[model samples]
Target: MRTAYSVETVRTAERELMDRLPDGVLMQRAAAGLAAACADLLRRRGRVYGARVVLLVGSGDNGGDALYAGARLARRGAGVTAVLLAAGRAHEGGLAALSGAGGRVVEHPSDTSAPFDVLAAADLVVDGITGIGGRGGLRPDAVPLARAVHESDAVVVAVDLPSGVEADSGEVVGEALRADVTLTFGTYKPAHLIDPAREYAGAVGLVDIGLGAVLPPVAELEALQHADVARLLPVPTGESDKYRRGVVGVVAGSARYPGAAVLAVAGALHGGAGAVRYVGPAGDAVIARFPETLVHAGPPAKAGRVQAWVVGPGLGEEPGVRDALASDVPVLVDADGLRGLNAKVVRARKAPTLLTPHAGEAAALLEVPREEVESARLTAVRELAARYGATVLLKGSTTLVADPDTALPVRVNPTGTPWLATAGSGDVLSGLTGSLLAAGLGARDAGSVGAYLHGLAARSAARGAPVSAEDVGAALRVAWRDVSEEA
Candidate 1:
């Protein structure tokens, strides 16, 4: 699993590490990593010896890292130029080092035309305009330079994080610089994993600087890898039977939307559940599609025995939502089932409850605008989990599963394709996650592992082309085998 920490936690760890090291030693270590990454990028494009490298230097340690790195590149016979946003306030030690290494410096002009010419002809641009602590976007004087860098054909590499993005909340309050790759130091930040800010960070590269020894074990965000998901997946033993494995009841669909029931059942069957017991108005549709499903036409309580229940996909005005919630087993609520959710009622339940909501649906539950939830997904998911006292899986480009416990690190799904935005995907996910719950995984583990498989299935089904939700459901077995193989 990959972990990301808050800015405050990372700063605390950095301070501790720096106290034991000699003066300027830590910065040099960072510079060495940054320069090596830049050299590798340049080497891939062509040769690094004659590459034209331009550094967007600012007034803090971020700029100093770039200046010292540029010196390294300059020594290797690359033409390195440092475009200082504030020449007077630049790092004195770093400026002297660059000058000593025969690197040129160009002060950012008020007119901005000179920098535009330099940026246009550059082979690579290192963005050190702002560090992780920067918020509210770039200053007015720096915006034009940022725009020029964007217009240039150079490969942009950001130091620590891209300028203008909130490090802790994953929020881009104003215009932010987009990078081809962002080289973060010590530990990952929240902005690198969560959306909004994550989109600006094209590809993230973590540089180890020995802070792992001092940093806390628990992080602000956790992204599960294939091995982690594999461990969480339920595998049947030699003594396992149909009932022993687990039964998941799905209360979904309506007369108007019978396909939702079929899709949900498809996902449930693909999940590691021994059997799927479905109770809804679309029993006939589900039976026709999946004859293996045990169907009932009434309340979920009468749907035979089930270890867990999935409620609310395309269930318009259904009475089974409350009945499913009333059950002693775990329950997953999604789509229509998410409407009019009672926090007190959910908190009082003996078994765990998982709520899966997209941006618009989450906005409705949180009583905020959809834009607010989308802009700050990390905050929205965490707040939703705390408010409802349930696990929340906020589905989007970057899926996040937050546990009710505030201290636990929120899990982020790393695998996904944009093609997952197809219809009925959430229904499939609800059934899959509920099946995991029935198989006895905790609410957090079930949601995170389900999302991991769902995303991988989508990617396999899509393969750079448009794919239907049914295609995603069909590809779940491939995703399962892929993860199992890794384990």
Candidate 2:
């Protein structure tokens, strides 16, 4: 699992490690890594010997990092120039080192156009205008410089994080600098993994500064890798039978949208479930598509036996929402089932409950604008989970699964692609996750694993082209085997 810590936690860990080490040791370590990465990038573009390097120096240690890295690049025969945003407050030792190494220094001019000539000619730009401690956005004085950097053809590399994003919430409230690459230290931050802010961070590279021994065991966010997903997936033994493997009951579709039933049943069949029992008005449509499904036309209460229930996909004005919610087994609620949901009723349930909502549906449940949910997904998901006393899977650019216990790390699905944005994709996810729930994984694990496989399947099916919901369902076996092979 790839984990991300909060800003406060990282600060505390850094302070602890700094107290024991020499004064300049930690900064030097970071500078060395940054310089090496910049050198590699320069080499890839051409050669570092004659490359033009520009550093945007600020008033903190972030600027110091760039200055020290600039000195290293200069020693390697690169033409390095430091554009100081804070001429007086720039790191004293860093400035001295750069000057000793024959690097040029240019204080930022009041007129932003003055730096345009140098910025335009640079091969690489190092952004140190702000760090993780910065909130809102860049200072007004630095806006023009940022504009100049963006207009330039140089490859932009941000220090720690891209300037102007919230490290803890992954929210970019105002204008922020976009990076071609972001070099983070110690561990990843929530901003590096969640969306909105994540999009600003292009490619991320973790530069270890030996903070692992000091950081906490549990992080604020966790992204499951292939091996982690493989471990969580359910595999049947020789003794496993249809009933023994687990039965997933799907309460979906209606007369208005029969395809929803077929898609949900398709997802459940590929979700490692021994059998799928579907109950809805579109049983005939579902049977036509998947003859293996055990179809029932009655309410979910009389649908024989099932370990878990998936409700609410294309279920317009259906009656099974209440029936499925009232069941004692684990349940996954999505689409129309999310409408008119009561927090008190969900909190009262004994079995685990999983709620999957897109930004729009989540807004309806939280009584906020859809834009707010998309901007601050981490906060919204946590709030929803706490309010409903159930696990939540907020689907969008970045899929997040949060448990009701806020102390646990929110799981972020790293495998997501924009290609999975088809109409019935969420319906497929609801069924896949419900099957995992029936197979005995906790709500958090079920949601995370389900999202991982769903994303991988979508990517495999799309292969960079447009893919339908049915294509994603069909690619589940391929995704399962891909993860298992790596394991």
Candidate 3:
């Protein structure tokens, strides 16, 4: 798993390293790593022998990294040019290195199209604009330059990170540099792992600057690998029978939206749960799709005992859902269940509760605007956990899970794709997680494992094109096989 710490944590780590390492030692290492990455990219394109590189140099240390890296590339037969955005304020040492290495510094482009021309002609463009020190949106001078970089055919490589992006928060405010590959110093930042900044940083390249140890156990989102997910999965032992594996009760669907129940059932049936007990208005539809499910109509009271209860998908504000929430069992609340949910009810519950909400629902539950939730998903997830006293899962391009009470690490699911935004996707994920929870995994493991499997299943189902909810459920078997085989 790859974890990202907040800017404060990184700053502390960087300060500690600066105190220990010799002066400019860390910068040299960072520059060397950046140069190596550029070489790798050029080699991959089969034009390392004569590739032309453009460096958009700003005033800060970020620009210094790019300039020093350009010197390295210039000595290796690659043509390099640096356009000094801050003419007089450019890093003196970096500029001297470039000039000494036969690289020239060109005047900053006054015409908006000039940078685009350079970017279009070059094989790769190095973005050395603002670093983590930047606040708000892109600066006026950098906005057009950024847009050109993003639209150009040339690959962009960001130094440290993509500029104008919130390094600690995943929020993308105004114009931001979009890099094909981002070579970062020290460790990963929240922006590198979370979206929409994650989208801008296409592929992350971390350079170990020896700042790893000093960083606090920061609140962050993490993406799990196959081995990690496999480790968290629960398998049946010799003494484990059907009941021993555990039962998951599902309270979902309404008379109006029966497919939610069907899709949820589909996920639960293939999910690690030994048996899935369904209680809702859509019993017939769920049974029609998944005959293996134990269906019950009326209420959860009539539904047989279960290790965990999944509520809310397609619930549609019915009174029975309130009763289901009142139960003292491990429960997952989603969709309609998140609407007007009381904090007292969650606090009063005896069983552990997991609440999964999308941006809009999360905003509603927290009494904030949807834009606020989207803008600060990290804060929103943490806020939800603290307010409701439950494990909160905020679903988006980067799915984040945070447990309340302790400052434990948050899990940011890496396997999800934008393609997973299809209808009934969230329902399927909830069922899979509930199944895992019922099968004896803790809340953290269940949520993380569910995310990992869901992403893989979506990729498998798509197979290159669009896929329906049914396809995702069908593809779960293949995803499971793929993980098991890897193990």
Candidate 4:
């Protein structure tokens, strides 16, 4: 598993390393990695013979790394130029190395956009702007320079991190530079993993400066790989019977939308649940798809048995839907269920409750605007979990799952395609998670497993084009086989 850390934890680790290492060792290690990456980018294109390179140097060590890296590029027969933001505060050693290696320095860049014009003609741009120490937005002099680099046709490679983005929150302030690739020191930051800012970091490359010893669990979310998810899936033993496998109960759908019942049942059956109890008005349609399902009329009270319950797919905001949710059994609330339900209902439940909300629904639960939820997904999901005293699964381009009691890191689902956004997708996920919960997984595990499976199923269903919800359900069988074969 790839772990992400907060800015504070990384800074503390860097400080510890700095104390133990020689004076300039850590910085040199960082500069060496930066130089190697720049060389590789040039070599891959087969065009470093006389290519021009521009470095946007800031006031901190990030700028120093870029300046020094420029020196290496200059020595390799590339024309290198440095646009220094802080003329006097620039790293003395880095400036000397660049000048000695035949790299030119341009001071007072704001005097003219000439440096930007030259930067536009360069083959590659390296942003060494404000690093992890930045508190506020970009400085006055750095905005237009960033815009110029952004507007350029060159392949942008950022040193340390993309300038003007929050390392911890992945939030963009003022003007942020978007890079085609980012080379970071030590370990990965939360912004490099989460959304919004993650989008700006086109492709991320990590350079180890050996800060792993003190790295804490500061990663807000992580995208699970195939092997990891496979280990989490339930594997049946020869001694185990159907009863030992676990039974799941689904309280969903209505006469108005029978397709919801079929889709949800499809997800549950493939989610490793032994027996599925269907409690809703669309029992006839569910039975037609999976005759093994134990269908019941009325509320959950009459429903035969359920180790885990999935509530609120198609059941509208009627009083009956809320009544069904009253059961303390492990429940996954989604679609219409997320609309009117309050945190009090979730807290009152006896079993663990998992709430799955899309961006708009999450905004409603938090009483914030949709834009705010999308801007900082890490904060929004954690807030929802803490407030409701339950696990929250926020669905979007980057899926995030958070638990309330412990800050045991959120999950960033790496699977799924745009085709997965078709109708009835959440319904499929609700069934999958409910089945996992019933099969004895904890709230956190259930949420993570469901998301992993759902994304994989979507990818399997639609190779490239758009696919229907039914297609996704049909593709689950292959996903289960593919994930199991690796084990």
Per candidate, the number of residue pairs that clash is: 0, 0, 1, 1
- Show model 3 residue runs off by greater than 4 Å: 109-117, 217-219
TM-score of each: 0.99, 0.99, 0.95, 0.95
Residue-wise C-alpha lDDT for candidate 1, range 100-176, written one tens digit per residue: 98899888865556677889899999999989889899898888888988998899999999999999988999889
Q: Would you give me the overall lDDT of model 3?
A: 0.85
| C-alpha local distance difference test of each model | 0.92, 0.92, 0.85, 0.84
lDDT, residue 68, candidate 3: 95
Lowest lDDT sum, 10 consecutive residues, model 4, at: 316-325
Error of 2 at 332 (Å): 0.2
Report lDDT (Cα) of residue 259, candidate 1: 91
lDDT of 4 by residue, 1-487 (tens): 7777777777888899899988878888888898888888888877776888998888899999998888988998999999888889898999999999999989745667668777889888898978976655678778878788878887899887788888888777667889999999988878887778888888999998888876765555566777887888887799877668888888888878778878898899888878888888889999998999999886787776678888888876433456556776788888888887778878877778899999999999999999999988889999999999999999998888899965588877767788898899888888888889888888888888888888888998899988999888888878878877865
Model 3 vs. true fold: TM: 0.95
Which residue pairs of candidate 1 clash?
none
Residue range with the least summed lDDT across 10 consecutive positions in model 2 = 109-118
For model 1 the TM-score comes to: 0.99
Candidate 1: 10-residue stretch with minimal lDDT: 109-118
What root-mean-square deviation over C-alphas does model 4 reach?
2.0
